[model samples]
Target: MDVIKDFPIYVAKKIKHETVDDLIRQFKGLQANCYDLMINRVVIPRDKKLKEIEKDGNADWRFHEREVKFIVRTENGSSISVEFGLCKTIKSLKDYLYDVKKVSIDQRQMTFNGQELNDEMILNDCEIINDSVVCMNKKNGMSIDIDINNVIEKFDENTIVSDVIKFRKPSNAENYDLVIDGKIVPRNMTLQEANISQQSKLKFQERNITFRVRLCNGSRIRVDMPPSKSILNLKEHLNTVEKFPVCQQRISFNGKDLTDDLTLHDCGIKDDSDVYLLGRLYGG
Candidate 1:
């Protein structure tokens, strides 16, 4: 009689345990679903749109979201006319290439008006308008001989210092400084701002300092930095390389916290010096 009475309670406890396990599995599945929705459906698209707005300094492009027709020309002289949505990302175009042209994303590299297009960048953000020509080439290591003068041979009065650099240094393009008449030309300065003409001779010099970044995961990353650039610049570079956002990065050296405004030179950070990087924890 006691066993029969206890059997109902025992069954109830077993059911309770199974219910908890099932609930946990369902909760985990829901979390995964939500994460996918947030990242793919919301976050990435929103980021692309925000970048477009920031680039144009207004939301004017949103009103003109029509089909963009452009040419994708391969290095081997083959070409195709692709009509895609203006709001679509370069990644989507790469997907189209994979689907139609059988060009694997890993094997392809693209450039527009002598500037490399990032995967996250939108078509309109790249200034790829109607009839724009996009050059497609096989993914080669950054060994392609680039003649700076030839690259900017068509430079006019409107060309900025950055334009020349981007045209020549397609990879890690930001790390270079333009030197004209033995003076470093400010990146934001135009030819007119620097009192230089299209015929002026210029030099692209990479002014970078190499250092080691130790992450919380016990892995180290080699960072090449311009000594004059601030810690904030380092964080931004890490954001690009490591995909960790600037806001979540906490950096320290010699057991002291480094402020964003402090330059690598200011911190007395030399080549190969170990800088520790930590990710900030959220929600306890």
Candidate 2:
């Protein structure tokens, strides 16, 4: 006669916890007597001590790390699958993209499913589960391509010429004689409105016109401006690049304040005209 004993096989799975303290408490409560434990693809001997199990390559057994897979869709309609630890943060995932996928992006500009992701938020906090799809958008600045007498030039569509003249002095930038399809392009016009495109051809003529902006401190900056540009648009450019608040900016010439609806040409401003700028200080 033969006697056989059969023990129930318990699937040894890693216990997941939100925090290290919780994991420690749960791990301490696990019964150490009369049980077989398996970790890291290695089976622990029944008579082995905890230190011996660790020395046998189960040092990270208590971490109980799990993998989370997410598919990130880019702006260009491309997607990549990224795998991360469950305890990792959104920022860590971004870093992984940068490191592994060669994606260069700012953390502040990252978004998932139309909602911006916080850097400190963990994958679990974002409710990201296995096989989740994340969408990432790139923040692109406005760009316009123009043809200057058959030569191509690209500029920011949102930028005003008054601000541009400060850096690069294009030929006849002041005269501002840019024409498209027999229509004169206004200096204040954005590239979007100018019908600027990579394929569009435009003509430009040199006009000997320049304007000077005199600050309250008596310092002056000379600019090449087309008289067709509006004073209001100039103020907006100053507000953006020079830290001059638009609400606090005042433009005056020849003892008359400039209005938004009027262009420099309408105000009787000609070449080499001097405009005064009054910027007010804002405080608490």
Best by lDDT: 1
Model 2 backbone overlap count: 0
lDDT tens per residue, model 2, 129-149: 676656555444356666667
Q: lDDT tens digits, residues 1-284, model 1?
A: 00123332333344333332232233334222111112111232322322121222221121112467888876555668999876678889999988998865676667675556778987867877787767665554232222354353544333445555666665445667888768888865544556765456777786887899999989999998777788899999899999999999988999888999998878878788999998765785
Off by over 4 Å in 2: 1-60, 139-284
Query: Each prediction's Cα lDDT score?
Result: 0.63, 0.58
Best by TM-score: 2
Model 1 clashing-pair count: 0
Off by over 4 Å in 1: 1-64, 143-284
